[model samples]
Target: MSWYQHWISFAKRLVHVVAKPMKQNSGQGGVMVHPYRGYGSSREVFVMGRVFRQAALGRAIPRRGVLRDTADVARRIFRRGLADARVDIRIGNNQLCITTDRDGYFDAQLPVSSALPVDVSWHRADIMVHAKGYPPVRTNVEIYVPPPEADLLVISDIDDTVMFTGVAEKLKMLYRLFVRKPHRRTAFPGVASLYQALYRGKSEKAERPILYVSRGPWAIYEMLETFFQLNRIPVGPILFLREWGISWRKPWPRRAEAHKRDLIDRMLALYSDMPCILIGDSGQHDPEVYTEVVKAYPGRIKAIYIRRVDQDPKREQAIQRLRDELAHTDCELVLAADSVLIAEHAYAQGDISARGLQAVQRDVDEQQNDPA
Candidate 1:
């Protein structure tokens, strides 16, 4: 292996060793269920969640301090998954039961027997976890079902696109992700406004479906959710994150291109009739992966907006080349400097309203004036 790869491998081993004690120190508690938001059509819906044995009381991390923050992040990463657990989900009159896999994740698609009310865009599903000795743990998850009046769909990446993760700089990204307090992590200027505009759409009440796909691991789900809530970014039906499995043989997570493409494909298949707008950053393989997506699903993608995070000339040239290649097609690949540019393009395309555009512009100005 190369020097860089060897160093990464050693770091992973050290992290595992240091965090092992934290895992062992976890107090014996009852079973816990973490249900992610679900999405569906009128006919069926997809639900997913993870099962874990809860930590004891007073194990919660404090709101301040870097060492405590790092420990909290490590605790989350090393939390034990309860495999072979049974999960029961109830939607109105229908009920479905499924078992968790080795990773304690349960994902299933269920047919909707009773018609969901048209007045509401969100529905609820009651979830209960059944472990061997622990009492049944109950929770509820919200599902998003787009109304028929919805005109478009949006799929976006989280890192560097909507938020400032410094993906091109590994050390900075790691510091922001692991060491910094959650409140200190900030989103890009006007990103929340732009996304809210997209959610509202041209009619101002369209309520179009916005789905987020991330290359980050599932262990950081709660952190990401809190970030979204704090930033006021329009929350999507789900944040599709990969399960990063680090072993001696392979010390890193799977390739991000494959994971993002698979999630985008699944979302497209689920919402077959809706035309989608893709948003990502040029920091990694987003341009190439999205180019492939445009090729695979012709005439379905309306436009692609790539945030220009890297200033490298070669990267810019590559993205421009992709844009040129797609010039003849219905899908337009737009490489923009910020969210305001994207919002303007969407407004010009009649995808978002005039008020929405103004809101994004105002937010951009405010952030620029006081970017603390």
Candidate 2:
């Protein structure tokens, strides 16, 4: 066999040996429901979470130490998903029952008979998990409902665009993603400020919806959320992350293009009246996927900002072609070298206020000048 094939075979064997023990020992204590942030409109809501069987529920990402963080990553990666578990969701006076799929994930869309309160952008849903042998587990999940005055929606990718994970370099990306502590994972300079500007839009009280999409697995959700909090970025109502399956047959996860496309489509469908701004990095297939989205959705997209992470001329030329193709449309695809440029263009387009642009510039300057 070729060297690569031999390496894959060896790796698969090693995983089988190491993971079997963990899998067998998992979920021996009790069943738990881990709720994720949900999103909704005035007339309907979407909520989701996972059921896991674990001895004790611990923080997904530990507070300190690289070793503890790495161990937590392993536990999350090999979590024992409780398949076919029943889940009950209640929002205000409305109630619904759903069951977990094979992967222990429960996703439900329920119609809201009464209009949700517009005073607050976030609402809460109570989730209860019931398994055959375990006691019922209950948790509350927060759902984000954009205010009526919201005019713009922001959709951003998390990898190379928001943070400095070298997505084009798989090994380095995995190391930074899995090994680094949440506090240690660095966000791109001024990304938090730029995103905050987009979140606020033109008006200070716009309270627009900012949705974060990632190619990373659901296991890293807590880490990503904590990272955003640490960086002072506005947390989205919900993070759209894919469930990655790893086995001897499939060592790597599937391509993320379809996953990302479906998420953007769902967001567009949810907020039919809102025009969206798409943000992603040019290192991967974001430009192509976003271009397809613009075509599919017509004039729904106001602008597409692709962060230029590398100096590859060919990639730049390809993105430029996409930019040219979008010239006739109302949407403009901007390949920006930094967040300042994006902030400037957004200011000129009237998407953000002058103060917001200045905030982004100040953030960029501070990050650049910091010795650390």
Candidate 3:
């Protein structure tokens, strides 16, 4: 192709470079974006916005902000990072704002005890001229719960295990899987009830502690929490993978996996000497990851429960491997139809009372057995 033709093609592709803005309606306040783009800048922008939300809510909340570029790069970045961004109100019934600033920062408010959808967005200041459209940013709200020490640390997966859709919903899966952020997620049958039981510590001798460890990016933490609170799922600390964006084949291909492993290690460190139970689905790496944890810390891990969302040969193989590895250990591996089965096991293992465990188990059984 001639030089002019090549230039034309390049321009076409550049024009086609799509920047999708995510707008999540959950109550939590944090920026959500693809995994690669999330770790550096968007997370910081979201945390900054959360301060505005907390001020409106009349309570102080722990907030964190990260500048997207590296320290060296940050120094060279635009002086007014996010300064060009603007938050404008009035978009039909919903009050909305958009940012076109260098730093991509925007502010929003969430009144205390108030439940309303707050929307914020980021776009290039130059791109606004065409008015093609501005993609809204995604935000997740984090709800704080007093630490539940000695309680059952009910860590579970958000994908197929609780939500009916396996591998997460395709339309939304990218947001969860690649974006590494939280958005609206589906609730699996009896998951809410089970989480409630675990969170409330309704069972005798069982601590009601809930923790979520998922492949979703950290950007979605607020969205995940909001979904939980909206659906009334048990609440707790949620661990997520950071978006490093570096291609695996390149210098940092293993960064994503390494980041996850580091996160898992930190989780174990926090719960060091703390007896805990694990809950997850069979859809993804949860099986293998959980197994490794059990093997690494024998008695510390109370139980391993995998939600049978679908049939997968590889998952089955992994399950078998976990069994083989745990052959000599006391850890129990179970395929629960729903949350109750886990509760039942906990009750039997003296984690909860017979009656309380039986009640939750029955509820899940009925939900799974229901024709609707």
Score every model by TM-score.
Answer: 0.84, 0.84, 0.53
lDDT of 3 by residue, 1-372 (tens): 676775554443222221111212122323222211111011111112311111011123222112111221222221222334354432123243455333334333212232223222221111111112334443333322223344545556665666544443644533332222221334665566666656556444333445565555444544455456655665554434343334545544344335545655655554454566777777666777778888877687778889877677777877877878787888878877667677777667876655556656676666567664
All models, RMSD in angstroms: 6.9, 7.4, 15.2
User: Which residue pairs does candidate 2 place in steric collision?
Assistant: 27-53
C-alpha lDDT score of every prediction, in listed order = 0.81, 0.81, 0.47
Candidate 3 least-lDDT 10 residues: 50-59
lDDT (tens digit, per residue) of candidate 2 on 1-372: 676775555444333333332332232347767788999898789998889876532556343444343444466566688998999898888788999998789899988986777899999999888999888877898999999999998999988898887745654443343434332337777888888888888887788999998888886676677568867889999888988877888888877998999889998999999999999999999999999999999989999999999999999999999999999999999999999999999999999999999999998888788765
- Misplaced by over 4 Å in model 2 are 1-28, 56-78, 168-185, 248-252
Model 1 pairs whose backbones collide: none
Write candidate 1's Cα lDDT for 1-372 as tens digits. 676775565455334434333343343445667788999988889899888765542456543344443564455555678999999898877778999998788997888898888888899999988989888877899999999888898999998897777646645544443444433446788988899999999999999999998888876676677668877898888998888878798799999898999888988998899999999999888999899999999999999999998789999999999999898899999899988899999999999999999999998888788744
lDDT agreement of model 1 with the native = 0.81
TM-score of 3: 0.53
- The clash numbers for all candidates, in the given order, read 0, 1, 27
Cα lDDT for residue 285, model 2? 94
